[model samples]
Target chain A: MSVRVVVRTFSELCITVGAVIVLFVVYVLFWTGVKADTAMDDQIAQLEEQWAKGSASAGPGDPGSARGPGAAAPKAVAYEDGRPFAVMYIPRLGFTWNKPVLEGTRTKTLKKGLGHYASTARLGEPGNFAVAGHRRTYGDPFKDFPRLRPGDPVVLTDGTSWFTYRIDTRPYRTLPDDTAVVDPVPEKSGYTREGRYLTLTTCDPEWGHSHRLIVWAHLDETQPVEAGKPKALRR
Target chain B: MYGFIWRHLPGNTWIKALISLVLVLATVYVLFQYVFPWAEPLLPFNDVTVDNQ
Candidate 1:
């Protein structure tokens, strides 16, 4: 090729490569969110169907009456990886700001919704029940996580009962290597004794995961599905 | 590069546009299906994790 033609070809190649890179960024930021939203909607629909059937068979017995304060605590059901076991609702985020809580904290699980740390306490139990979610992309379920404030209510339901947790502290920035944020007592929360705690974890700074944003809450109340939604959830 | 492709292709402007579209899509497909997957683990995206300590 002549010198002029060679220069023209190099410019064309550079433009094509630049366009490809732009397309890739669009795919990662936009297409992934679309796919995640579809997957989460399907998962939520399936869980709702299962809960409807469960309640139908359980009859009119009040769920709260079965597990009152003095009653023996029900056995915690084992959850399979990537399987959703509960739905989390943060009224402060928005009335529609709810996501399915899956069993494990793997990438695949977080794409569907929130992922519960396997080592943490189970929902509505004594220790710290911790969950992790993506702050950006993959539906960005915790996109508004920074908006949470002390006294904000984070509610979760396992189809039969509703667990309402009150945020006691603001978002605390921590390094990715700090696992003590989810400890049974969570010394980071200044607790020395065991108590019912809920921990929400997500990537800090919106688009990056260099650090983690931790929010600690205490279980404030528990009610049955038959008793209607909790007062915190009331509009 | 595009000039050479245009001269070598045996079609009108419409057909050339279609061919160019196909080539771009094929490039993307190869990058995502093979190249990107190979490079993913090398990136720091998945390095975000809390230590057991």
Candidate 2:
């Protein structure tokens, strides 16, 4: 090929590659969020449908029992992998901000919504109930995690009961290998004994995962579904 | 490069535009379906867990 043709062809190839790179960025940042939002909505809708049908197998006890003296103990629901068992609502984030809590912490599970650590204690249980969510992409369920403060409520519902947790500690940074943050009695949160706790974890620095940002909360109260709504959820 | 592609094609402007659109779409489809999936494991996008290593 002639010199002019060669230069022109080389420039054209560079432009094509640049366009592809931009497209890939768009796919990762924009397209993934759109797809994840739809997936999360569908997952929430499915969970609501199951709850409406009263088909959710929430442990062994009768789910109709109300919270009071002599009421039956709330059994920990047996959660299946990739299935959503609860809906988490963070009023501090937004009035309408909610996400489905899936069972496992795999990439596919987190993409749908927040992923509950399988080994951690269940919601409202007398242990550390931990959850993980994406910080930057895939709908970014915890994108505003740093905005949470002490006394903020992290409420969750399992179709039959509402569990509200009050944030006691702000965002604490730790390494990705530090699994103790999700322990039944978390070591770094200043709690000496076991109690009903909730831990929210996400990637740090908005877009990087070199470390984790953790927020520790204590379960404050529980209300039955027959109760219209919790005080914390009231606008 | 787009100019070169236009010159090499034997169609009018409308036909050239259609052909260019198709080529871009085909390239994007291949990248998303094959290239991105193959490259996802190597990327650090999904390693945000605090699990015990």
Candidate 3:
């Protein structure tokens, strides 16, 4: 090819590459958020529909009876991986702020909603119920994670009851490998013994994951769904 | 690169332009639906948990 034609082809190739990169950015920043929001909505709808139908296998059984004196703790639901079984609302994050809590922390599961660390205690149990969420993408579910403060309430519903957890520590920054942050009695979490706890983790620095931000909370109360909304969630 | 395709698209000017638009959109759709999602795990931005070792 002539020198001019060669240069034209090279320039066109550069323009195409630049366009692809920009479009990839658009896909990551906007398109993924769109798809994730829809996925989260569908997850919530799935849980809601299941709740509305009152399926026989609903595992959190008879919250009212479970809480009575001499009654056993409610049975933990056997959640399938990547499936959402609860909806969480962080009042400190916002009154309208809510997200589905899926069963595992896999990328595909996190894309739909917050991922519950499978090893941790299930909701309202006697150990830490840890969850992870993206801070900048996949709808930025925990983008305001740093805004959490001591005494903030993180309420969750399993359609059978409301489990309200009270934050006991501010957002604590730690290395990503500090898996102890999700341990049954997490280090630096100020608990002397095993107890019902909640740990919310997200990427540190808002848009990067070089580190993690953790907020530890203790289960403060449990109210049956037949009762009205929890005090923290009362409008 | 576009010039080569524009010259060969069998149609009047407007029709060729429309066809080019359709082709570009189809390319984008493919990238979003399959290519970008397939490539997403290789990028580091999506990791939000300590479990990803």
TM-score of each candidate?
A: 0.87, 0.88, 0.93
Model 3: chain A TM-score against the true structure: 0.93
- Runs of candidate 1 with Cα error greater than 4 angstroms are A57-64, A69-75, B25-53
TM-score of the second chain in candidate 3: 0.84
Model 2 RMSD in Å is: 3.2
On lDDT, the stronger of 1 and 2 is 2
Question: What's the lDDT of the predicted structure labeled candidate 3?
Answer: 0.86
- Give TM-scores of chain A for all candidates: 0.92, 0.91, 0.93
C-alpha lDDT (0 to 100) for residue A32 of candidate 1? 64
Candidate 2's DockQ is: 0.49
- Quality of candidate 3's docking, in CAPRI categories? medium
- For each candidate in the order shown, give its overall lDDT on alpha carbons: 0.80, 0.83, 0.86
DockQ of each: 0.36, 0.49, 0.66
Q: Residue A181, candidate 1: how far off, in angstroms?
A: 0.5
| Residue-wise C-alpha lDDT for candidate 1, range A1-235, written one tens digit per residue | 5899888888988998898778667656786688789988888888899889876886665443556421223534687788988899998888888889989887767778888998888888888899988777778788888889999999998887889999988898998989989999888887778889999988777766678888999988887777899998899
Which pairs clash in the backbone of model 3? none
Task: Kindly give the stretch of ten consecutive residues in candidate 3 chain A with the minimal lDDT sum.
Answer: A68-77
Pitting candidate 2 against candidate 3, the one with the higher TM-score is: 3
Ranking by DockQ: 3, 2, 1
User: Per-residue lDDT for A84-104 in model 2, tens only?
Assistant: 999999998889999999998
Query: How big an interface RMSD has model 3?
Result: 1.5
Candidate 3 per-residue C-alpha lDDT over A111-145 given as tens digits, one digit per residue, 9 for 90 to 100? 99999999888888888899999898789889888
